[model samples]
Target: MIEVTNLSKSYGSTQALRGVSFRVESGEIIGLLGPNGAGKTTMMRVLTGYLQPDEGQVTVDGLDVLTDTLEVQKRIGYLPENAPLYPELSVQAYLKMIANLRQIPAADQPACLSEAVRATALTDHLTRPIGELSRGYRQRVGLAQAILHQPKLLICDEPTASLDPTQIVEVRRLIRRLARHSTVILSTHILSEVEATCDRVIILLNGEVKADARLADLSATTDAVLVLAEGAPDATKDLKALAGAENVEAYPTPDGHQYRVRGAGGVDLRPAIYELAHTRSWPLRELRRDVRTLETVFNELTTQVRRTSADTGEMKAGRRGSDQNPSASHLSERR
Candidate 1:
């Protein structure tokens, strides 16, 4: 379990995080979602004790990160974006080294190293130099070292940054498997990754917490309706008359007519549509509610943030959401 409150960090005149706060429950896989420079890495650094926050507190299983950093580090496994590793070290040797550093008993080294290798699918690359491995293999090696210590919490920053599609699926599967036993906090800008791997998400924007909720909850919050139906004829007029529907668009397809419906609030129209079909027997082919994808929800939520800043003339109008380094003074504020 982890809790972070009011975390703030700044670098010179630019602020990296402003009052960001969130919690990760035990055995939950949480995605830290944001655009580049949204302070995702900054928050991760503080949580992992790689960097101290300027004006917030972080606790891991009730242990203060700042006061009990060593203990906190012992309970956490961190794989940074670059996964700092020695290029010359062989895969097996590097994990063995990390296991030893983690104070894994000398006799358990072999098992620990083997577990890391197997979990990351690095068995074949055990003897290969880290620098010689492909980007995907190198990422596995990085992950291997992180879990070698068997920490209770796993923190990965862009764990699949350079991997191909196959490798990305493999790594995502691996993370999900690991989360069955460990709390995972994965920081990524990839929406699909979050949708595939995270049970809940915390969206950060301009160094602040924008949204924190479960994937299902966020989806429900958006009043988007999914419609799947095959019918004989133009039922658009009848469908629109149903409760709480808007943006009702019907397009003709070879199979039948397809319709997309949007509602202004959380309204259920399935019953009405079903009754209409039953009463008229309109030769309905199919009908179902539309579920908004994580991508759509993410865009919908952040659009307001971007527009508000632009309208208020507060946003400098840069490329938008770029990662910048935090200064020492901000580090002090983190404490």
Candidate 2:
């Protein structure tokens, strides 16, 4: 289990994380989703005790990451974006080195090595040099080393990045297998990865959490309706006037006009919409509830943040110019 509260980290003026907070229950697989520069890596580093937060706190299994860094490290296995490894060392030798570094007793090293190798499917490549292996095999080697100690928590940052489709599937299977023994926190930009492997998803944008919910909850039906109809010249205005219709937009289509109608307070406006269409003699081609997918939710949240940031930047720039030229500021004010 892990808990992070109001965790903030910055590099000079650039804030990498801002008020990020989340909890991971035992045995749960959580996916951290965000675009590049959205603080997914920063949050992962802070959680793993590799980077300290400037503000806020992080605890893993009730152990504070800052004060109990070693203890937390002992309970976590991290596979970083770039796996830390020695190319010169053979697979067996590298794992052995990690086993020793993780403080596995000599008596337990053999069993641990065997289990890790088996779990990651690296038993056949034990004697091959790491540098000689393909990217997929190297990723397996990275996974094997991370799980060598059997930590309670596994943190993987972009574990499937740059791998072929077959390799991605292999790594995803390995991650799911890892979850049987340890809680997982996976940071990836790939939405399909989360959909395929994660139980819950936390979406981050502009260094802040935008959406955090279970996959099931996110895939639920939206309180909106999609309608395809014809014979109404002012379909947008008519739809907006219908009872329970909160927001309405109508777009011209090849066959007819397509209307996106949002309901008020989770109300279903389908019955009222059908009644209105029948009274007005509009031919209804299609009427159905709109369902929101994970991709749709992700794009909506991230794009809104980008637009807000751009507007704020423009406003600040305008104020700065106005201050520099008071005459123009007065003229604009008068206008």
Candidate 3:
């Protein structure tokens, strides 16, 4: 539904995006992963026509974003990190204003507004002022306005930024539902958000594309396992020889031992271990596969990027790992 080619943007001496390129398929929810100042927001802004790229081509549904700016804008629903809301406006009024501004059909405005409010679970706050709502509710209001027009593309920069865990889940459900009909580009600092909500993820680092792969594929690792076994200390060496066993870290236990085996993603040396255990009649207590998490994957990528820059002596002050959780995601949780 969206395609970006050789996109580059610069502000004075600072380069925000460098030769970034990616594609988004229709009805696909893509997570735009990056640290602060990593050009995620800039990309979103360019896609939404709020900011024009210095160099690149952006197209949505085969139409050029620059040439067909209005059409593209009409097809997209954007919820920026900090929602630009009229604080004094009641929830209902705020949505009505956005609906009208988006040129939603006058006859369908009421139903559209009603649908958005219901989708975001803001029905009870219809008459309440936007400012009076909690951060979670304010986020809901922002989301309500975005979908009020039923745009074909939804670009949310930190959609669940200021909500509690429960609220985050609720918002993720809403986004999942949104993906049923429209393409979604959700920018979040939370790797878990990508794990939970996105079908695919694009990791952006230092203004460039670092990784672009399906979430399910990356989440399916074959080489790492958290294992526990009760056997003699020498058993660790024998077990390490099993096919697919790359490295084994062993710790002694009162009964036997604890072993963490690392190898290939699909490597299953469990049967080999079982065979060895049976031959020796050793008491095997625990044998489990280690599962790598999204956090680990994200940190590994960002840390590698940081180290590479440091090695070349080209590191900048702003360069950092993208694994840190966003401020807004934690802000509302505290409240």
Q: What is the number of backbone collisions in each predicted candidate, taken in the order shown? A: 11, 0, 11
Model 2 alpha-carbon drift over 4 Å, by segment: 226-269, 272-287, 313-335
Q: How many backbone clashes does candidate 3 have?
A: 11
Model 1 residue runs over 4 Å out of place are: 220-266, 269-290, 312-335
Q: Of the candidates shown, which would achieve the greatest lDDT relative to the real structure?
A: 2
In candidate 2, what are the lDDT values of residues 1-335, reduced to their tens digit? 99999999999998889999999999999999876677888998999999999999999999999999999999999999999789999999999999988989999999999999999999899999999998999999999988898999999998999999999999999999999999999988777889899999998876788889889876663545545555555677788888877788665777777887877765677888888878877767888887667776665564466457777662111111345653321111110
lDDT of each: 0.78, 0.83, 0.78
Sorting all predicted structures by TM-score, with the top scorer first, yields: 2, 3, 1
Which ten-residue region of model 1 has the weakest summed lDDT? Answer: 326-335
What clash pairs does model 2 have? none
User: Evaluated with TM-score, which candidate comes out highest?
Assistant: 2
C-alpha positional error of residue 114 in candidate 3 after TM-score superposition, expressed in Å: 1.5
lDDT by residue for model 1 (1-335), tens: 89998888898888999988788889999998877777888988999888878898999999999999999998998999887888999887788788877889998888878887888888888889989998878888888888888889999998988789998998899999888889999988777788899999887777888778798765774333334345476777877887777657666667777776666565656666778778867776666777666665565556566568778866521223224422111111110
What's every prediction's RMSD, in angstroms? Answer: 9.4, 9.8, 6.9
> What C-alpha lDDT does candidate 1 achieve relative to the native structure?
0.78
